[model samples]
Target: MNPDIVRWSYAAASGALLALAFPPYSVWPAAVLAPALLLRAMRRAETPQQAGDLGALAGFLFAALSMPWLRFVFGPFAAGLWAFFALGPALFGVLLKRLQGRGDWLWVAAAGVLWAGMEAARAHLPGLACPWLSLGYAFAPAGPLLQAASVIGLYGLSAAAVAGGAALALAAEGKRIPAGALAIVAGLAWGLGERRLELKPQGRPVSVALVQDESYDVERLAAMTPRDAELVVWPEYQAGVPGGMVDRYREHLAGLTSGRKGVLVVGAATVDEQAPFENFAWVLGSDGALLGRHDKQHPIPFMEGRLKGHSDPRPVATPLGPVGVQICYDLDFEDGSRRLASRGARILAVPNLDPASWGPLQHSQHSGMAPLRAVETGLWVAKAASSGDSMLIDPRGRVTARLGFAGRGVARGTALLSDGGLTPYVAWGWLVVPLSLLALAAAVADALFGALRERAFLVYPPSPLGVEAES
Candidate 1:
């Protein structure tokens, strides 16, 4: 086969494999194979630009295949979004190419760090941070492996996944030592995760009910509320209750908890005299008293018309426990949930809205993030989604109960309210991003220094006898 054709084929295969690693296909091994193939393709590149181009090709394909749901919202313009996300992978390829020729182990380690650094950067980009389909999420369905997120957050898992992939690529090139070392490390992590899963969770068990309805009708949802539940949640924008009607709706919705001891968490909209509408989650006590409200901190850019919430997210004190509320997109990022966990949140209630028009894949993919958040915070997650996939996830990242996509019903489950301290991820996992950044900087500096030395040597050649040539 022609070398260029072979490299292109590998890049294309890498993208396809990665796409399959996410829902609804969810072939987990494909996630590992994806990066390995991309690395192989890049290895064949004669120049950094060619490597970056190959990386971009793989990234574009992965984004296009995995996020077709964007088409429902952006139409043909979704192609532009895919291309924008491709920049991360393109940068990863350039860095990997430059960092090569370090020991195989160091190169492998740098590959993982560079990939993770780029992912962190992409996720925090000023106006366009989309953290969808991260490599770590491919393991979300694996209960034992997912527990690793409790100690290292999603970015750490992403690093491990990419490192494993790089190791695999090296193994394929007949390099066994580094590959075996990484495999052993991965095995140990898995063992620890399984052992962690065996430990019993210490917390107060409270019955929770998630109302999943598309109509967002207050009366309909109120009727569906379970009276015995200690916590009742409705999906985001549950009526888009106008700013002026929030008080009236709160009074009426509180009727759901009339005879029960439950707290009602309803998703709605709020607007002040000066600002436009803000996505808000209302916490109502049993007697119709307003406990607190959390505005959606990370509103979907361009797609959502609401103003970005500026308030710090803290748990609202409830009779059940301190319940933290994260509106749909807020859960996609680490900041809000980690802050809540560090501040002593006992349980998390997420009100999500995924229109059926966006497709079931979108709902499933979005719901997958709940498990990661659950493990990271060591709190039970009660996610109420408008169109479906409302679920209850335990601290171990296990989906205890769920309602399937495109359904209108209530998901009932027990949530354990943590009296424990923040999980390691909530407390210290933030170090992963900064550490990765520092490691990348070192690798780039090493590459530049090596280049500079080579150029200097060429400018002043040494004689065959090891003496400098006379000018």
Candidate 2:
């Protein structure tokens, strides 16, 4: 809370601002938050030890704030995550201080490698592995920029971003070196890869209709009104609430269809009487009949046993071709999108809802990322956000149209932005292992063997030779 220590708090705010790129709100500009943190860390040392601690503080705040939603799973949520992010980064920052010196570029190099490795660590931490934004998101809107992910995977972009962030900090204080050069090369590679992918194009588009209904009313929609929906869609937890309360919304769903032959995809809190509560999407036929249903695969980390396996993406046979479903958080992961496209999905449908957390920047960020999914899959993805940005995207990561921010009860057309087949990214998964391994190796080496480097003297200065002068 002190003014001097307030810089750490500044780091936390920067992290939250960067997080606007994720769900509920999709503002990507929030990413500029990182550079501020990098700037703070690149400075004269009060003590090599203290400087390292500061760097660690910056890293932890960045990770923790960016992942505040994680508190929902741990229970008694809110503010508890501060300790985790605040105290956590101290360790790595301590290590970073050992590398700082005049004309030293390794300080930033180590920072980027360590940061990327840290992100990879959180991503693989089993119960905590949520790839909220693996750095690849920065280039999501630049369609050709992420084409390199097809071969190297998301971690490549993560390493590149880390290196870029760290190198920029050092370059501002000093000059360029391997770190800056590597970052430039990585950026160029993405451009080249994107250009190569551009040569191949899918044929045709599919017509789609997404329902942004608000009938759930903090309770079960089925139990609330005249049951009648041959085809309709709802948001996460909108159809059922307070447990075992879905019977109420059946009539509301039925009414949306009115006996017309159409697809009804509902995002609701689903209960099957005898089964455990689930956040599910119940797909209906042209006449209010059940066709196929898919549960969300990647529920928010920690919000499991309830929303667990609720956001899995899968394709269902439809007249417009096999339509795919990628619920709210599902689109955040590249695998879900790749899997659906691999399975012949030409029209992707994401039935997502975000009411409590809403902002203009947030919707724009989500819309920006949505097209990356579309272009990668070479299919049309209608991201229907009940309270956020509902958008239509084509195969080239281009948005045809989008619904505004938190537009309650607003319905609009996205025309038919569709295409066929799949991109190389869809054909490959976990292909980024090699790059991840390299980054991990660099991190481990620095952590264990950095004491032998010349920069160590800056952190732990050598004793001065003293000689007594004769009187």
Candidate 3:
């Protein structure tokens, strides 16, 4: 059998396994196996270029398989998106090939760091920061491992996941001692996370109501909202009212909170002659007074046309407490939620708009990020989607209440405000981005230096007179 065929088969299988690790299928063990296979294939590659090609192949397959819903959003252009994102894994392969041969344990550690660094870079790539299907997200549904996010953040989880993969690859190659050590460390982390889950949130319990419907009808949503609840959340763009209609709807929306100590968080498109349209969440106090408006930050690239909101996100003071507001796409990233949590936000009210046309797969995947955010920031997330999957996630990443996909109704539940201090992630997890960038730069520099040194040797052979080769 040809060695190249076997290596490529490993790459292909890795991609398929990685896709299965994400939402909808969510085979957790596949997450560990996928990278193990990819690492094995890369180890067999004759050159860095071949290793990168294999990585690209696996990444492309993972993207195509895991995120087919992108086709509905981007038509045939979805292929370009997949190819673009695949570069992350390709670079990881190149770095791994260059950074190997240090030691088995060192190589495994580098693989993990390189994988996480690439993901961090992918999440912040200029206008194309799409952090979907990240390796860490594979554990979002796993109760025990999911708690680790509260301490290390998502990128740390990603590093640990790939490290486990690299260790598995080593074990397959007869390096059992180090592989067993890595497995023990992973088990310890999981055990710690499991124990951490037992810590209960100590804070005031508030009744929250999530009003969800396919039709972004203000009347219908208002009718469905529970007045008895202290906080009522509506989905994103629930009212696409222009400037003229804002005043009328403001009065009507205020009526929902009238005669009760309730706050209404409604998603609306603010359009007027003075400025471009914005995806805005309006917070209405019980007395019909406007509290604070949070414009959707981190708008979806290519798809969203609204002007990007530049103001820093903070919690909106309400009768219930300081409630943070975030639009649909904002929850996908960590910055907004972290900032809000740091600013003493007890509860986060998210207004999402995942339409049914996007498919249930998209809805499930998109909604999974909420739990990650909840765990990372120690905030109770009340996400109300227009089409479905409205949920109330506790600080520990537990889904206390949920309305499944394609269903339209109100999800009522009690959310405990975050009373404990900021989790470790909220305090220092942002360092992951900079640390990743620094590590990536160092790896690239090391690779370039090595290439240049090798080229110098090739350009000028070793001197016969005991003289070193000239530069």
Say which candidate scores most in lDDT: 3
lDDT (C-alpha, whole model) for all candidates = 0.84, 0.57, 0.87
Lowest lDDT sum, 10 consecutive residues, model 3, at: 462-471
Select the stronger candidate by lDDT from 1 and 2.
1
Cα deviation of 126, candidate 1, in Å? 1.2
Model 3, 1-471: lDDT tens per residue? 899999999999999999999889888888889999999999999998899999999999999998999999999999999998789899899889987788887888898888888998887876787788888888988888899898888888889889889998888888888779977887887898888788877788889989889797787877787778888899998877777677787877677546746888989986575757778899988787899989888878886745675549989988777889899988888888999999999889999999999999999898878899999998899999988799999988988889988998999999887467999899998788899888988998988898899999999987776554332
Ranking by TM-score: 3, 1, 2
| Candidate 1: residue 401 Cα off by (Å) | 1.2
Q: Candidate 1: which stretches are off by over 4 Å?
A: 255-257, 271-275, 438-471
| lDDT, candidate 2, 206-313, per-residue tens | 344444544555334333222232223445556563354444455556665454545767676654646675766776666556666678777666555455564346
**Of 2 and 3, the candidate ranking higher by lDDT:** 3
Instruction: Evaluate residue 348 in candidate 1 and report its C-alpha lDDT on the 0 to 100 scale.
Output: 89
Give the per-residue lDDT of model 1 (tens digit) for 1-471.
899999999999999999999999888878778999999888888877789999999999999999999999999999999999789889788778876776888778778888888887777776776678878888898777888888888888888888888888888889888779977887888899889989988777889999999896777888888878888899998755655676786777676557757888888875454557778888988787999999888868776645765549998988887889999989988778888998888898999999999998898899878888998889889999999899998889888889999988999998777688778889897687788777767766776787789889999887576454532
